[model samples]
Target: MDFSTLCVHGCSKRYDTTGSVSVPIFQSATFVHPGVGLSTGFDYSRAQNPTREYLEQTVANLEGGADAIAFSSGMAAITTLMEIFSPGDHIIATDDLYGGSHRLFSHISKKNGLTFDFVDTTDVQNIKKCIRNETRAVFIETPTNPMMHVTDIAAVSKLCRENSLLLVVDNTFLTPYFQRPLQLGADIVVHSGTKYLGGHNDTLAGFIVVSDAALAERLRFLSKTTGACLSPFDSWLLIRGIKTLAVRLERQQQTAFRIAEWLSKQDKIRKVHYPGLPSHPGYEISKKQTSGFGAMLSFETDSKETAHRILERVSIIQYAESLGGVESLITYPMLQTHADIPQQEREARGIGECLLRLSVGLEAADDLIEDLRQAIYGGKANV
Candidate 1:
């Protein structure tokens, strides 16, 4: 089935009890066993839930994976995957990554005896040189957060396959609707369902899709044992949100392209980083890998004061950290999403205090551009 059809009809079925087209949320905490010797499919809500199962199955199918597991948050899914490696194991990850994921790899994982080396994965040779005998996984996020750097997924996946290392790709920026990492040879695909998968800011959830059945089983065990399973209600919401993903993402992508183009022509903007922009460094690779340019974009201003002034002046876009929602959001990466990283390290990666990240929404292209234009020019005109 095509992606559009799968969005609406995948893993969702009408039931007699509700007599409704929408899948009913099974909110019960536990399921009854059939008898002493026999048991139903679900024994407890924490271990399994009908709604979450439907969501997991749908995500797995969309990503072309054997199975899927849902977690409380994106970090929960990531930490669970990290658990597959033992102490003294090393990981090679992209230097430009989601701040939260970077924190886990650099700080939290270190305490657990996991070591990480951050390198620019866009240069495949550099990534190969960073791998060591102790390396267990290659963590990648194409079109990385804030910087919008695109890593070659297939190249890294091939390297991992040759070296007997796991390749984990964070697919949050371009959801399965736009890019399927598993189809590109990735071993595991991770998502912050709170973003595009949910298509709204109401729910916080995470999902992992893996082509290997054994890895799926291991993730299931870790999910149940660690108690990071997603709640039934949130899972139901995610299911509903995913049904309209194609439609929502299409509109959001259009807006993003327009905004990115307009931002590039602005005098106050020093540089615009968006895969859709023809001048973008990863434009060719992005076209080869993703079906569409995603809804996230970033631009650098002349100064930190100018960036903050624009952020404070914008009326239509909200000042928020999360992205991939129906509504537009603007964030100062240095202080908001990437604040956890040390100053020197962020500077080394070219993430400056003057850089602003925007998650474009399904709004009128002209209105969004006007709002941004005014924010940047209005403050100075008044001054």
Candidate 2:
């Protein structure tokens, strides 16, 4: 089936004989067994739930992975992922990432005895330079959060294979609709399904997809032990959200491209970072590996004053955090997404106070442009 069809219809599996169009939420925390020693394939919600399972199967199918495990939120998925390595294991990760991930690695993971080297993975050579004998894996967020720095996943994956390392790619921004990291040789694909997969900003969810059954089993064990699995109701919400994923993203990408073009032409905007633009440093690599340039974008204003004004003025385009939803949002990474990183380090990574990240949504392009224009120029179309 085409991806569009898959998004709408999902797999052929039916949850019940009722023939309901939606996956039913198995609200029970524990299930009744048919026999003393036998089971009905489900025992408890902590281990698994029918609704969450259906959502997991759908995500696995979309990413073309062997299996996908769902979690309460993206952080929960990532926190559980960290358990795969023991104390003293070192991991190389992209310098620019969601602030939560950085906080986890720097504060929590380090205290737990895991060390991390944050490098600009846009150049696979940078990642290569960071690799040490203790480095067991590489974690990457392509078209990285706030910076929009696109990494060559295939190249990094090849390097990982050569060095006997696990390559984990955070596919949150692009989602499987635009890019499937597993197909590009990623050992594990992680997502903040709360973003694109959920489509609406109504529920929190996360997933980790792996191509190896052994890895899948390991992750499942960890997730069950942690007890951070998604609830049946939230899983159902995600299932419904994904039904319109294809259409929502297609419309969002179209609007984002238009908005990026507009931002690039503004004198107040210093530079626009979007892979869809031909001038982007990783444009060619992104084109080679992904089917589409996603709806996420970031721009650096000429001054911190300009960035603040835009954030305060926007009305229709909400000034908020989080991305990939039906409503467009503008965020200040310095204050919201990348604040966990030290000031000097954040600026060194090119995430300055003047930078603003935009998450294009289902809004009409022209309306969103007008909102931004008024926000930037203070009631004027352009300054």
Candidate 3:
């Protein structure tokens, strides 16, 4: 069977008891025991829920991982994974990263005695040079947030293997359908399922998929201890969301490529950051590894005023935070996504006031293109 089939029937066995096509939400907080000192493979909601398990198993299969864990939010999944390291451990991370992850690493993890070094992972040498004896893991976000810098996951994974370091890849921007990092030698894969995997902005969820059983066990223990598991209702919602991932992403990617090409030709646009475009820096590398270039892209204007005007003027594409929904969204990275980083650091990363990230959705290509035209030029497109 293909990806769409797996999305719908990957974990159907979990619903064998009810014989229902839709997985029922196991909403109970606790399970009953049949006899003394006996169990039914589940005892509490924090440890496991049937609905969450179905979603987890399906995701694990899709990502080619031994196990998958679900969380209340993307941050929760990352925070729980961070607990695997002891105090004073060091991590090498992508320089351009999600603001929430940066906050967790710069402040929260540092305070807990863990240290991190940020580098451009796209250049394997940058990561190789930064490795220290205390470096336990190399964390990266390929096609990094706001900047759209693509890292060579296989190359970095090789370096990690040589140094006896774990390779953790954040696959949020391109879900398993587009790219599966586990097959590229990454030890663990993480995602903000609230974005692509959920396929809608209505629910929040996160996932951590691992090929190594030992790593999966440790993460599961941390998830249970932290008690940040996704609720049964939200898990059911994610299941429905993922069932449409194949079709939704295809339409979204098509419109994204069309919009990116159009943006590149505009006089007001200074630069476009989309892997699907031939002119994009990551185009060749992206084609070599991932099955498809994802829908997320970022662009810059000639001036901050132009960016602000377009964001304010756009009618069809909402100016908002978060991405990967059925509806198109345009976001100002400097103030919205990367605001947590220090001003100097954010500017140094090339995430300036003129940069704007766009998450293309299921909207028609012509309508989306026209929306950008009117927003940037403040006039009819002469269609």
Please give, for residues 1-383, the per-residue lDDT of candidate 3 as tens digits.
79888887767456556677788988999999989999887799999988899999999999999999999999999999999999989999999999999999999999999999999988999998998889999999988998888888899988999999999999999999999999999999999999999988999999999999998998999999999999999999999999999899889999999999999999999999998888888889899889999999999999999999999888889999999999999999889988989999999999999999999989889999998999899986534
- Backbone clashes for every candidate come to 0, 0, 0
Question: How accurate locally, in lDDT, is each candidate?
Answer: 0.89, 0.92, 0.92
- Worst 10 contiguous positions by lDDT, candidate 2: 374-383
Clashes by residue pair, model 3: none
Badly placed stretches (over 4 Å) of model 2 are 380-383
Assess the local accuracy of residue 322 in candidate 1 as a C-alpha lDDT between 0 and 100. 98
Kindly report which residue pairs in candidate 2 clash with one another.
none
RMSD of each: 2.0, 1.5, 1.2
List, residue by residue over 1-383, the lDDT tens digit for candidate 2. 89998888776777699988878889999999999999989999999998889889999999999999999999999999999999999999998888999999999999999999888898889999988889999999997998888999999999999999999999999999999999999999999999999988888999999999999999999999999999999999998999999999889999999999999999999999999999999999999999999999999999999999999888888898899999999999999888878999989988898999999999889999998889888765532
lDDT score for candidate 3 against the true structure: 0.92
TM-score between model 3 and native: 0.98
